[model samples]
Target: MKLNVEQRKIVELEPQGHLAVKGVAGSGKTSVAIRRVSFLKEHYCFEPDDRILLVTYNKTLLNFIHYQFNQLSEEETYDSFLSEHKTDVTITTIDKLMYRSFKARMTRLGLQLKTMTNRRQLLKVMNHALYDMKDNYKDVTILSPKFQNFLLDEIHWLKACDIQDLNVYQEIDRIGRATGSKGMPQKLHKNSETREAIFALKEHYDRLMLKEQWVDFPTINLMALREVEEHPPEGYTHIIIDESQDLTKVQLMYITHVQTDKPHQSIMFVADNTQSIYHLSWLGKGRAYTTIGFDMSGRARTLSKNYRTTTEISKAAYGLIEHDEAILSNVDFVKPALIDRHGHAPIYRFFKDHSSHLVFLKQEIESLIGEYQYKDICIVAKESRFLEDIEQYLLSEKNSSPSTQSSKTRF
Candidate 1:
């Protein structure tokens, strides 16, 4: 694929210090990021120990980026760039990077880090903490089963944003949770009583983890951030982060510390704020660039052209969130301009009951099976339970062998 004008500008940007690219879906943000890696290698002179790093959010994206690099290395157009600028680039997910840092820190402290791979074990610890909280906290709302998930989210958000002080958390506005006329219940962070209870629960949870020498995902990030802050890494000349909107504040801090202390080192973050589903408030508050300590005065760019979805699809997707007051209040919404292509407008069908919906889904799958391969057809649901219901119905009633590989099943 050829680079568009905006993408070319990003790829060839000079002095690439703290560059942030905000582009809609299919705006070639990832492509521009990958090309910039090659551009840095080709144009910049590096010491023998200098390193380049590419950080992604998940394994799927990490694999896709590796595939892109492989294709670039073999392509005739990029052969010269690949051969001449042969600098080592490290590609990894944020989770793996944090885990490595956490492990190294633990080793240095002579502590054995117990990895909790089982969800049930973590849940058991949480339940125990809640049980203990019932006696210590005055708010009975925290004891409700429905409040568990919300409490967990608040805890994770606090840690992700590096809000260790309860006073600071209470003073800050909760941006991600739904408020006002949205009809959704107000979040617990809004209520002083519940906020106290949540903080107590977090403390209890932490004590339990400390007692057991166990570390969960969020704790790993917090530990890693502290480790990196005290002992910044070395030899990194350039760092590129894709899907940066999904990253939390602590993770971003870890990225900053992992880079070398060179005066001319560069870091680039490519993100679409509209696609941020991780619920980080800094991006919604229009302070994401500054929050990461980056002065994006002349380094920021936005890609307006969307080449992925058709006009109809783009409009439909935008329509879903266009009037969402919560979303509008937080994100600087940029409406994408689609290429001159037309497709069928998204369809919405309503069924009276679950059985009817399954029947319709079965017929649709049977119809699509003839035209497309199994892997090409995906069925998405708002929750995993819905997908499980669909899978069970298909297997027991329809006698079909549908694959439920992930939340978004492909069969």
Candidate 2:
């Protein structure tokens, strides 16, 4: 397809197997993408309904792309019939994409998934507790919704921390939706006899969704990635990745797996290195592309533009970050736009005398919130130790002054 200067290079550039787009905030990358897609449909000769999946690192970006697509279509003003009849292009967050693929395979794995999977497990445990107390149980469906949701949320928190087997088999079944390493199943046991008894009651709740089709968020990625590694997507021509910086090592491995068989098509990786701040796995030695092994079919384009932010805000924000400037040097397209944002000239207070500080704080609070009619004022202390001292002092002051509104002071 014929494209304008920018779109032509992104879609039709030489050695074009994968397109790696390194775009800054204001680089018009989205405009380029829309033009590229439209060109492909109009002239590049892609089937209307080819499995062209547009995946984003997060939901927010996914939404942005969806909005972009809508706006572009509107501007182009394609016939309503052609637009409706065209083969649908799938645009979604990576998680949702993996979820679709994983859910399919998980159905064959003999697991059931329920809507409120975690809560159901918790209810079974509660039921077991009730059984122990009442001796004669009437039914399982009589539990309160509020209590069940609470137990399920509690299970989710603990599961995240790996403290206990929070989700049931069905919950894990639903987890087959993500692309990553398939985690080991939890051993069903408890600290006390009663807890064990509760667990036994809850274990059967796994067979609720379907006899063999349950899946979960993490498992979805694990299975989908595995499938691609075993048998890559058929006729997979190109891969365009957004939010590349936020993607994990495992996630990258999965993408690599997808491109292995069809290494000739193209790979497009678009990312803002400054946006997604994650811990670098390598301590000091730099990360090598060959070590992880990336064979490129296309050039990795580096885009630099300050589209969103003003020079002043960008200058100030850049100072706060610590990184190797060589690896991360890129012109920002979007920087903070408003004048003097984020309290540029912040008030700095230092008091060596404790009594004097307390006196000043009390007077300041009273004047700002009470006399000045300020609805809310906050004093932020980073550490817990400092907050604790402030809390104690506030309590002592309020106790001494019974006339003051004790509820007004919130540390």
Candidate 3:
């Protein structure tokens, strides 16, 4: 369990200073971060229960990480380490972390009370504001009259993502469907690309909410960042931000001040520019998306040798990603050294005809499952909706499960 070369370099480079780890997918950033806490615990001689925040954008990922460590904390693996040091560490999503930070600092920011809620309520509040203002909305929600129907549909989609309260969804639907629904924007277009922008506007609305005595997520962040600058959080010694590629411009700006204000505090940022998922949020006025590489391997380090997939799988994955210049433009990490993968040859096919393509695809799937006994086959489609038909066929093929994200498929 001693550190690997890359992990050791990362530790040696910045045990207590500004550091950043950048690498491609499956490059072991999580392992590095986990090992980082373990290393620091021993080196700093810190108590096991002291809190260290591990933040990520996705809750699903957070759950997996907790599962990963829980295994270590269990009897089969590093149970002894968990027994002796279980009290020392903590991991949580960035949103929760930010909310916690905001709660602690709310009083400092002239707030009497800090509250947290989901997105559904915020949308309703925004819609209400638009209604009361008679659709002017200062050009906020009512982006245009032409796209009001689209807006309602998008609202439904948002509701789907936030289904905790059917009452709110029903209310929003009722209000949105009312022929007299008001405050439509004149400029916004309803399209797939506009989805993120809509969510961001919701974020922006959250920020402006406080000015009019209404508040939300972006508002919490805006004020919280300022509050932290004025009054730093106590107890926490270092800050390491993961999935930094997914951070928004405002979030980065917030982190910058937090890092500089705390002296002798280690600030480690690990991000992959190629995986900058929120790149559009950095467009136009701000040069935030093209986050300049912070070569903190100055404590910046990497463990690029992926020990996950075999040589063939790694090569196939690499072939799909590396040769494509567009995806490659954002990454600056080494391709994993292809390892031996049991002499399996990955067959790829390209079809000029759609009918032939479907036939060929089914044939391949049948060949793999029938000829190779590959029972755990997961066909991940980019457009989630595409899996519906495939799922049906697979289920009809015999004993597949019906539990797809779109529809149900038992496999």
Candidate 4:
């Protein structure tokens, strides 16, 4: 497919330091990223062994990016482009990158090589820490179960943003949990007393994690940031990030540490703030959630033309997002003109009971079975329990052969 005018500019432009691509959904940000890499390959005289790193949030997205690169290379007639640079190019989730860094420094740091075996184990540790904070500190307020969860969540958010100091954590507002994101209102940590207590609990939790040698997700990122600061990775000329809006500050620290500081080297961040699901890690309000401090002065580019979904669907999605005042403040809110394609309008159904909903869902699946493959169809649910219910219904009632490789119903 031919590149859109905006995407073409993004591919052709040679940014001096960093380039931030703020693209709406289906605005071809991914395509632009792939082409930008290809453009460098063709024009930049990059060495055969020069590193080009691409980072994202998840394995699924990484796989999709690799597929897009393959398709783009083929279309551009850069035959064997990926194969030639296979060793030089790195496309992976931030977690894997952090793990690699952690592994490299594990011996020197004396950090235990371990993975979180269960989420419940961490939760148990957190609860114990909370209990200790309440016992040790008379000033620390005893918290309810709901408030305890919020405190733990806030601590994780602090760590992601590289805020380990109690003073700094207490001073911050929202702790990167956007008001637009899910959960109850901003009722927790209203007073300095509450924040102080939470900070104490956080310190306790940190101590417990260290004592147990338990490695959690936030610890991985914290360790990765430290490793990058102490021993920067070599050979990376360019760094391209997808879903950049979801990235935490410490993650950006790692990316900055690894990439070369040469004048010609390019670093690109492509994301749509409206699709940002990591507001909790942002630790601030409005645009601060999406803008990394490192990329504050980067050249900003916005891609508004959407090439996916119908006009009706696009309007509906945009309308829903606009209704959230906090989210709208951070986004460009450009109402995209959808590709001209006729399709059936969406339908909504409400059932009085779970049984009725399951019955309706099963009937709908049966109707589409002949026309579509099971793997091609997707069923999304707001809650995981709903998905679990669907899974149980499908297995028990339909005797469906569950695909081990793919999640038939993914959240």
lDDT of each: 0.75, 0.48, 0.53, 0.71
Mind giving the per-residue lDDT tens digits that candidate 1 earns over 1-411? Answer: 468777897788775467878788888899888888877766764676667888998999988876676676335344454465456667789999888889878987898878775766777777888887777665455565455656666677887888887787777777757553323346645547667777777888888988988877788888888888887756478999998878888888888888876666789888887887665535644554776787777677888777988999988988898897655664445678878988999998999998899989877877776577667778899778899998878766443434322225433
If the candidates were sorted by their TM-score against the true structure, best first, what order would they fall in?
1, 4, 3, 2
Runs of candidate 3 with Cα error greater than 4 angstroms are: 1-3, 12-16, 45-51, 70-88, 104-142, 145-220, 252-264, 276-299, 321-335, 339-345, 351-375, 388-411
lDDT of 3 by residue, 1-411 (tens): 334677667755545656667666666777677566655655653443244445666698777766666555323344555566665444566667666667767655566654435556655655653344443344343444344444544443442223233333333322112334344433333332333345544444444455556554555665566666677654445556677666654465555554432334566667655555442222111232334334343455555665656677777777776775545553334456554544575777677975576556566666565344434666766554567766656556444422322334354
lDDT of 1 at 132: 78
Residue-level lDDT of model 2, residues 1-411, one tens digit each, is 123465457654543455556665655565555455554444433443343445567888777766666555334633442365255444557666665555555565554453333645546644544444343333322233333433333333222222235333323222111222223223323343433333433333333323444443333455666666665654334456666656644455566665433333445566655565443221012232343456433355655544456655455555555354534443322222333334344344789887777777766766665445424666667566766776677667876654345455344
State in Å the error of residue 335, model 3: 4.3
Considering every candidate listed, which one attains the maximal TM-score? Answer: 1
Worst 10 residues of 3 by lDDT: 279-288
Candidate structures ordered by lDDT, highest first: 1, 4, 3, 2
**Candidate 2, lDDT over the whole model:** 0.48
Per residue, candidate 4 scores C-alpha lDDT tens digits across 1-411 of 468776898889975767778777988888788777777766763565467887887888888776776565245533477677777777789889888888877867775657674767777888888766665657544444445556667777778778777677666666344343345434445446766777777777888887877777777888878887887778478889888767777787788788876767878878776776664534223454234544444477888777777777777777776677666666434446666765667776899999999988877877776687677779999888899999888767644533322435432
Which candidate number would show the highest lDDT if scored against the true structure? 1
